[model samples]
Target: MQPQFQSMQTTGSIAVGQNRVLRNTYLMLAVSMVPTLIGALVGIQMRFSFFAGSPLVSFLVFMGVAWGFMWGIEKNKNSGLGVALLLGFTFFMGLMLSRVLQVALGFSNGGSIIAMAAGGTAATFFVLSSIAATTKRDFSGMSSFLTVGAIVLLLAIVANIFLQIPGLYLAISAGIALLSAAWMLYDIQNIVRGGETNYVSASLSVYLNLYNLFVSLINLLMALTGQRE
Candidate 1:
């Protein structure tokens, strides 16, 4: 009887810890948005376009900086520096996203497409996050599969810099949106199941998933709705 009681207690304690982690992750996720907004506004105002002459050059530069920022954030995850780094990374991402915004704003229905995409993304996030928070089923098994899919997709995207295939670019954008949505579910579940104990890392993972999803959705909308002046 004592052993049974102890096991139950341990399980309860773990559940509580996971709830706390999820709560903190959520709070930090909300806080990180300010920086993103600031970055977007600044970049747009500055007419920031990365390596306009070479998409490949821009892609490499962006990826290098993004990964470097993520590394720094992880290494400092336990300190105040982690918070700063995470905000910095989000700001950089927002700046990167501004190019898409710039192009989208050029379209007649650009504003409409952007609004639809944002609303759709919010709806998707809400549904997936709710499932992660309330569902009892474990989803960790999908992590390996999702990781492989993401890597393959990334390579394809990188290759497209030179290939410049419109069809392939559309496929990759659609794939990324789907994968990142799935990843958001997985990451949220990891927090719910106690697989992710650090809010810093957890927030970073979710932030990236959301950011990627946003970018992919924007790309899809642009492809569908963009018209020149």
Candidate 2:
């Protein structure tokens, strides 16, 4: 009876710890959005572009810089520096997003299209997150499949840049949006199940998922319904 009681206590403690981590993760995720918005506003004003001449070069440079930031964030995940680096990364992402946002804004109904994309992304996140939190389903099995899908999506995107194929670009955007939604579900479940313990890392994972989802959704909307000015 004593052993069983002790086991119960241990489990209870673990549950509390996981709950704390998950709560902090959510808080950090919310806070990170501020920097993203600020960066986007500034980027729009500056009209920043990573490259003016070479699309392939711009893509490669952006990937290198992004991976470097991710590595630094991972190395510092347990410290305050991780939070700083994560916010910085999001800022960079927002600046990157300006390119798409600028193009979207060129449409006659650009504002409406952007708002619709944002609303759709929020709805997707809320639904997936609620399901992960309330249901007993384990999404661990999705990790490998999502990873493979992401890799394929990345390759398709890079190829499309060079091929300049409109059809493939739209298809890749749709694929990315679906994969991002799946990733968000998987990530939230991981946090709920205590599979991920670090809030910094968790925030980064979830933020990337949402960022990708938003970007992809905007691309799809532009392709499907954007009205040319």
Candidate 3:
């Protein structure tokens, strides 16, 4: 009876720890968005264009920088520097995002389309996150499949840089949106199940998921409903 009681205590403690981590992760995720919004506004005002001359070269450079930031953040995940690095990375991403927003704003109904995409993304996040929090099923098993899908999507994106196929671009956007939603579910469940204990790392994972989902949704919405001025 003592042994069983001890086991129950341990489980309860772990659940508390996981809940704390999830709470902190959510707080950090919300805070990180402030820098992202600032960066996007600044970029839009400056007419920032990442792919200035060569799309392929600019993309390669961007990927290198992004990975470097991720590496730094992971290496310092236990320290305050991790949070700083994560914010910086999000700012960079927001700057990149401004290009899309600029293009979207070029359409006659661009603002409405952007709003619709944002609403849809928020709805998707709410549903997936709620399921992750309440459902007892393990989603960690989906990691390997999701990783393969991400690799395939990355390869397709690189190919499209040269192919410049509009249809394939839209298809890839749809694929990314689906994958992002799946990843968010998997990631949030990891937090709920205590598989991921570090709030900093967890927030970064979820933030990336949200960013990708938003971008992909915008792309699809603009394609389907955008009206040129």
Candidate 4:
């Protein structure tokens, strides 16, 4: 009887811990958005360009820098430094987004399109998160599949950079949007099920999911509906 009671207590403690992590993650995710917004606004005004001469080189450099930041954030996830690094990474991502935003804004209804993309992305996140939180279904099986899909998508994106095929570009954008949504669900479920115990890492995962979702949605929308200026 005493052993059973101890097991119950252990389970209860884990539940409480998971709840705290989830709450903190949501708070940090919200706070992270402010810096991203600021970065995007400044990026648009300044017309930031990573490298004007070579798109492929710029992309490779950007990926290297992004990976470096992710490694730093993971290494410092237990400290305050992790939060700072995460915010800095989001700011850099916003700056990276400016080029796409600039392109979207070149259309006659660019603002509307951007708003729609944001709204759609938010809807996707809210729906997926809700399902993950409320449902008892385990999404653990998706982890491996999604990881493979992401790798393939990344390779496709890199290839299209040189191929410059419009059809493939559209397909890649759609694939990213789908994968981002799935990842949001998986990440949230992982948090809820005590699979992920760290708020910092969880917040980073969710933020990246939302970031990719927004970017992909915007690309799809602009490609299909954008009215050129």
> Tens digit of lDDT per residue, candidate 4, span 43-124?
9999987757687999899999999999999999999999999999999998988888988999999999899999998899
For 68-93, candidate 2 gives per-residue lDDT tens digits of 99999999999999999999999998
Compared with the true structure, model 2 gives a TM-score of 0.97
Give the better candidate number (2 or 4) by lDDT. Answer: 4
Query: Candidate order by lDDT, highest to lowest?
Result: 3, 4, 2, 1
Off by over 4 Å in 3: none
lDDT of 3 by residue, 51-93 (tens): 9889999999999999999999999999999999999999998
Error of 3 at 55 (Å): 0.5
Per-residue error for 37 in candidate 3, Å, reads 0.2
Q: What is the lDDT of candidate 4?
A: 0.94
For each candidate, give its TM-score against the true structure: 0.94, 0.97, 0.98, 0.97
Highest lDDT against the true fold, candidate: 3
- Output the TM-score of candidate 3: 0.98
Better of 1 and 3 by lDDT: 3
What clash count goes with each model? Answer: 0, 0, 0, 0
**Residue runs of model 2 more than 4 Å from their true location after superposition:** none
Worst 10 residues of 3 by lDDT: 113-122
